[model samples]
Target: MSGAKLVQGNEACVRGALAAGCNFYAGYPITPSSEIAEIMVRRLPDAGGVFIQMEDEIASLATVIGASLAGSKAMTATSGPGFSLMQEHIGFATMAEVPCVIVDVMRGGPSTGLPTSPSQGDIMQARWGTHGDHPAIVLAPSSVGEVFDLTVKAFNLAERFRTPVILIYDEIIGHTRESVVLPDRVDIVDRSRPNGNPSTYQPKAPAANGVPPMVAFGDGYRFHVTGLTHNEHGFPTTDPGDTEALITRIHDKVYDHQDEISAVEEFMLDDAEVAIFAYGIVGRSAREAVLRARRAGMKVGLIRPLTLWPFPYAQVADVAAGIDTLLVAEMNLGQLIGEVERAVAGTTEVIGHLRADGEPITPADLIAALPDPAGART
Candidate 1:
């Protein structure tokens, strides 16, 4: 605790969760993500927190939601398959406006594809895993250190927005061990608690930021919470006006604050003609490719979205406007590339370098994908 230590990405997540005041963890063991649950079990109680291993992924998420409603910052961790199982509860958390965090350490999958290997196939799933149209905040971290930092940010965002936040890590990052200097102090944000009389409190009353103040159950504040479209008082209502207001508020809470919620790390975009847009582990390789390309006198840059959802359209568009060609590298078969293409909208040529063979994309692979600098026009 005094000096830098070698830590795995999954362990860093537990440390970050503890730093963020996470007091409850409920999860089922799944490969790559199993370490997170193991660490939480060992650490949570020592920090005066609670940890429970539920029967299944679905029950794990449900328990997490229950803990959040009971006034605790709660979380659950899982891999691709478990994530698939928790989709319904994730939507429930969104609809009920529950504040919690979900960590998905991605592995290859379309149904248990590769348990111990890395993949970015869940990029789109993180955005659209749930059934309905709702806002989502998904953060993808590329390094062990980032895994720690972003997990804290995920919890903060969850509390601030009053919704579930996803922290995504691929198998490479989750299992890889690296020396990391843990920060002595980190910024923590707690959910906004209601201040008015309990009897008259409207649990679903919209705040200026489009997030309503939340009160835990048994806080002397009696209120209803249901997945169904509810009114301002937290009751199920079929009223068209009330339904519209609730749904619209949920969407705007994150989308309207896109600038603040979306974070991107841009590498050497100034005067660049070609760009590589990547995330998760692939972004790490893209960083190396940019450095190597620059050393070789090629105007190449990298755009890594630390926040994957809300898609970082504005940032990507700004960078895309100046570049002639953009290459999207990922472990999936062109999931994020489609978003880059949509954001660029023919202003620049968008290409994808994808691999789903349970291997990490390499810098050489990315460099080879770059357009010829001499032949390409800016």
Candidate 2:
């Protein structure tokens, strides 16, 4: 477990979840994401955890949410169609302030469009999948090693924020095999449990950090949880003032700490005039394009967002300010480029190199879109 070994992204996700203290998993099998469920089945029992293949994705998320409420760290994995079915429960977890992890291995999709092919079409969906205005924490991994690390981070963030977290990986990364060294230990964070008298416990009460301490259902602490707007005591509230406060608290909890939650990987950006913004598997190609552009004396760089939900706007804007043009490469028909455009805000010219034909954007493809450095302003 110490030395490097070849691992697929799906398998790495299983290991990471187990290591992060995920004691329960409930998921239905689906292409490109089934491997995660398969591995969890073989491994969870040995780790003193529970693994159940639910009837469907909806039930899967519901079961995970119940287990989380009962004091177990839980997770689920799915592809595009399955992800669609779990939207309602995802909203439930958010409204109830449950802590759990959900993995989405992206494939070509409106409805099972291409089960085995890679796509980034879910970028917008992941951000706004569930109905209503809810905050989300999503992490995208570009490599097997990152898949392992980010899976652990996902669980930690979910517990820390008392909300659901999504770990997004494209089909290409999920199916691809690469060498990864398992670390002996990783920093772990557990949800804070209520320490006050059971009679005085208020599950929905506002904490200074905006994350309320959680208590288990059978712990003799009385509390109510509902998708409806709730008061500090956790009961359904009809008061306009109470409803507004509840919604604002949840949104502010994430957005107010945006700097702490956002993460981006910058490559050769310090002195570059042109840049490539990408994530997931396309980031691999963007890195190569940046190197090739540098070798040819065209100062180009790459910015890969490791945390996609918060969107890394500040870091992206900082990079955009120094560059004359920003190129966004993705496996979708320009899904993420919109975010890049908003972040840059016309300070620099933004263009996209996109494909939905189930093929990855290559280094040469991104290079071709790069503006001529000799004529571009630095």
Candidate 3:
């Protein structure tokens, strides 16, 4: 706890969540992500938090969401099939604007495809799986160090935005152990509470940040909240005009402030002809490739995403200026590369290096794909 320690990504997630004041965790132990729940079971209660292994992933997320409504910093962990089951409840939390975190240690899948394998296959799922037009923040960590930092950031972002935040991780990063330095609890941001009379308080009323004041069930406010479109008083509404307005606002809250939510780390990109776009486990390799290429006098660079949801598109475009090419590497066939292409515009030749065999790509794998623009294509 004092200095850096060797730890796995999933274990670091549990540690970071606990430090962020997560008091309740309910999750199913699925491959890749099970270490998160396992870590919580062993440590949560010691920190005055509660941890329960539920009947299934559906029940696991349901239980955590219930705890969140009761004013607890709650979370659940899962992989592919389990994430599929939690979709309905994820929608419930989104519609209700519940503040919570969901740790998704991704694996190869459509349905139980490869349990012990890795994949960025859930990139779109994490964004659109829950149904409806709700907006939520999602973070992807490339290293075990980020696994700690981003997990805490997810909780803070969820509470600040009053929405569910997904901490998406891949199996390669989740189960891999690395030395990580824990920060001194970087200012936890909790939702502002209503200070006036409990009788006059309205849970449905939006705060200055567009987040409504939330109190536990046993609180004297006892305000009503539902998944349906509601007014300031938390009642269901059938008015499409009003519903449309509210939905737009929800999307704006996060997207409009993406500068604050999105983050990325660029390496040697200031003078490179080719840029490799990567994230999660593949990013670790991408970093090495950048260093290797620079040492080899290849003049290549890297762009690693820290925030996947509110993607650092503008940053990418800025770095891509005058660049000759972009290479996106990932465990999935191609997911985030599309975003990189759109961000780079027509200034560069965009391409991709993909691995879909449920295994992580190596630094050499991505480096070998970097095209020498001055020398022409392969």
- What TM-score, computed on C-alpha atoms, does each candidate reach? 0.98, 0.97, 0.95
**TM-score-superior candidate, 2 or 3:** 2
Q: At residue 60, what lDDT does model 3 achieve?
A: 88
How far in Å is the alpha carbon of 259 misplaced in model 1?
2.1
lDDT of 3: 0.86
> Per-residue lDDT of 1-378 in model 3, one digit per residue for the tens?
568789999988988898888999998899989889888999989998898889998998889888998889999989999999988888888878888899899999979999999998999888889888878688999888889899999999988888899999899889999876877667798976788799888776777667777788887786776888876777888788778767877888788888879988888888888888888888889989888888777888888888988778899898888588888898888888888888887777889898889878998797678886455322
Assess each prediction's global lDDT (C-alpha) against the native: 0.93, 0.91, 0.86
Worst 10 residues of 3 by lDDT: 369-378
- Best-matching candidate per lDDT: 1
lDDT of 2 by residue, 40-127 (tens): 9999999999999999999999999999999999999999999999899989999999999999999998898999999888888888
Report, for all candidates in order, the number of backbone clashes: 0, 0, 0
lDDT of 1 by residue, 4-47 (tens): 89999999999999999999999999997999999999999999
Winner by TM-score between candidate 3 and candidate 1 = 1
